[model samples]
Target: MAEQAYTVVSDSETTGEEKTSSSFPEIAIGIDIGTSQCSVAVWSGSQVELVRNTRNRKLMKSYVTFKDEVPAGGVSDELAHEYDMLSGAAIFNMKRLIGRVDTDPVVHASKSLPFLVETLNIGVRPFIAALVNNMWRSTTPEEVLAIFLVELRAMAEVKLKRPVRNVVLTVPVSFSRFQLTRIERACAMAGLHVLRLMPEPTAVALLYAQQQQQSGHENMGSGSEKIALIFNMGAGYCDVAITATAGGVSQIKALAGSTVGGEDLLQNLMHHLLPNMDDLFSSHGIEEIKRMGLLRVATQNAIHLLSFDESVPIDVDLGNGTKLSKVLTRTELEEVNKEVFEKCEALIKRCLQAAKLEAEDVHDVIIVGGCSYVPKVRNIVMSICKRQELYSGMNPLEAAVRGAALEGAVASGISDPFGNLDLLTIQATPLSIGIQADGGDFVPVIHQNTTTPVRKEQIFTTVHDDQAEALILVYEGDEKAAEHNHLLGYFKIRGIPPAQKGVPEISVCMDIDASNVLRVFAGVIVHGTQRAPMPFMEVRMPTVDDGHGWSAQALHKMYGSTLDLVTVKKIQHRDC
Candidate 1:
């Protein structure tokens, strides 16, 4: 019953090759690891089928309890009561915590949960722990997720009567390349191979494409390309996507998302219910943790009830003669989470604008995820798209996993007689990839929303006269400042022929394959020739992991622009 250490797989160990043959193809399953819940699905030879646990439930809570010497996940272990999960012995919401630095605001907000989330406010991983046998037991987000995934894999294996290995996972569009690496590591720990990490909204878009194909609406428009907008808001993230579907192909035009969703709304309501909740539970004592758990349960229940009823009564009694009793109106709940709603609205609009489409150009609006049930959320999405009703073809909660299943079949090269498996989801980069140039400004070599399986080259020059070397600081984000973005990695291009400022042409090429793996190529180019003066340095992206933000600062301090490059003409060549 002792905790076991998991071996984190290196990028070299996992290839993006399909492990199947003609006689028998190993079809991958789809997994949607939501902040609050999780689900698994697979292609059942002809159609997509949602895999249920032993309890015959399609959905399972996303949490892991460490009360006993060994840990148990929600996949196989049933909680006696909802309050048991909040008893400081269960760890949840790891989707929001994984790969985030301690300086992140989301990490700071998570401290109020009925568990220990200690942060130093520095650029490093936060300290997370769960109470076990009245002692603080430290653990990492990846470990908890691996334990849960192991259970999921076991359940699928038992149900399907085969070894479940390859999987397609749904992730937030806002997740950085570094964050994705962490997710891959978790999958590796569970002895599963990640086939693809589809964006949540993009996965929804794929499901929309499938539905359109089945309903004979694939060519509804005159141009045969129907534009649809997808909005997905789960517990930890909100994502938006605009796609053009035709003949079962969904080309994602744009993607936008943020780390704001039902969790924020829940926290906002909890704070509104108890104005001094933070002060009341600062100590995190046994009694205080119990009280926080009670209040959280009350607030969560009220939120769910207000989604249907106009008003809900919330009543809870704390041990220290503290009580909360009030009539929570739907309007008041919406008011408390005004910022969250606004953020969602902004994301949808941003995605539309990025896709170069107007509200009227949208052929359909698809809203999915747990937050889609909220009337306020529905109104906001409908208002933004100027639509009367959301598309009712797919279930809000199951769209992502279903889409992932479809993708799994396609990626695994499984063929269907009825052509149901004839589907494709063309993805776009969710964040811009660039290098720090021109006095710490982010110079994007490959802009966000660019179609994937792409390769782009941007020419840069040395900033200093007669500079022999230049440092390439890679980053991922849309931020104008390099330091404000997520640093992917850094490398040096040496042996540059001593040239004057802006005289040398350093061609920096970036390649993003269909699986979203990034590899950066940089070398010095000789003028009047289409070749590099030296061997090109090809390095995999996200070389720097763990406390990358702080590493960026340290890099700046040590070098201090001693090795800098400025952007020249950008030459792009894309393959989609």
Candidate 2:
């Protein structure tokens, strides 16, 4: 056997002396990387300490550059405050694009964000467009994430003077499997072990409910006030859930969100104020002025301020005190932000309707996410709540991150897991459960939108006599074609005996865990049906198909040592 050496990717087990620096072997940190700002907080012992910038400010601009090397800004360790210093940078609206199809509504909306759009194409991926034109250097979404993680870890490292190990990450419920995988890999690359990934709304609920209980409040209502809705709107994304509070434990009723958030509203405001910015690409070449990188940011700040009050007097520091000022009235900005309100309203209504509650039926309205600071946004949510007693105390920007840190504390054993928290029920994604058919229609074992942690089995048969193996590909999403939608994974059941056609029965069951990650199992239904039924196991995943990874022996049996590239290409497409 080859000499074995295992690397320590996570915390040391309980064999050693208790770690004195942290309550748990692994120190816990929660990072909220948002569009306008990113915040990193640590739950060391008893209190949570948020790392401040040089000026003792809490928020850090989610900006990173990749020129000579990747450098980041907005949270300087230095003692100076400068926003314009850069090497070649990209900001955080990238979160809005994660896990989206190229044509998604939010992807379209992200283009309207206050950043330069790079049209230059470099890689085979669309993520490249940001690089070739120099709006941001060519960087993968995962790489961008790695840079952010590096900066955060450095900040914590400076504070502790020791390496921080274990962490829990929070992703929006909107994340697809690939995006989640990418995030996990980025953490691995950054030399941190991810203990778990809690969805944003769920973490927020835990944080909110826990705090309420600490203040001597529980089960905020009996039967009359059974449920409350969380309206989480931020600059980069929006999430809303109808959480039921029985004695103050918030449980998810149903949840939904999108890449479109307050930033989109800001863009809408910009188009109203500066019509010229819309023609930025055609009038001025993208590479030149796009690299200047300040026009959209100035406008977005003005728009964000307007959300707080009815009107905000705008100031754009073009340079040398030559400032441009204009007053954007509530009505004018309202016309621009109408699309955002409608989308939010529709999602909220859908969630409420699914929970079988009318707008007036919901009891308490808890608004969160920084975007909720907008006066008009508060008004809209209040109208939906239809009750004066609704509590809107939580700070949206800080709430999710704080909730995430609390979850981290619990996860890493720094805090007690049995500690009381508000638990609410929420809707599952894709809305239906089904198996694929020959013609592409979904034969639902469980209907779409059903509550999850569900297991429904489907059987498959061999198409050919004397078949030794079978392939079952599972998928998620709403599409008429098998080629479209998300292909979660492909399963291969091997070691079957030669049998007549349709003799073997393959059972496929899928289960969603508490955290909602999916697992798939395939096995022979009966021991005699094959030899011994393979034990039900995990969801099979795909591997990168780099031809070079194969060994010489396997390669020789498949093909001769020297082969034509044309023949290899032919085999790839014509394997069947």
Residue 73 accuracy (lDDT) in model 1: 88
Residues 1-576 of candidate 1 have per-residue lDDT tens digits of 122454433444434222433357789999999999999999999788999998899999999888776788899765543666557888899999999999999999999988899999779899998887778899888888998898999899899987777899999999999999999888988878999999988888888887788777435443388899999999999999999999889999999989999999999999999999999998787788889888888898998999899999888897789988889999999999999999999999999999999999998999999999999999999999998988888899999999999999999999899878778999999999999999989999999999999999999999999898889999999999999899999999998887789999898999999878899999998866545556989999989989997898899999999899998754576553
Reference-based TM-score of each model:
0.94, 0.75
lDDT of 2 at 326: 83
* Top-TM-score candidate index: 1
Clashing residue pairs for model 1: none
lDDT of 1: 0.89
Residue 283 lDDT, candidate 2, scale 0-100: 29
For residues 14-75, write the lDDT of model 2, one tens digit per residue.
22423554453665788777765778777656655676655666777665544444345446
Q: Candidates' lDDT values, in order?
A: 0.89, 0.58
RMSD of model 2, in Å? 9.0
- Candidate 2 lDDT (Cα, whole model)? 0.58
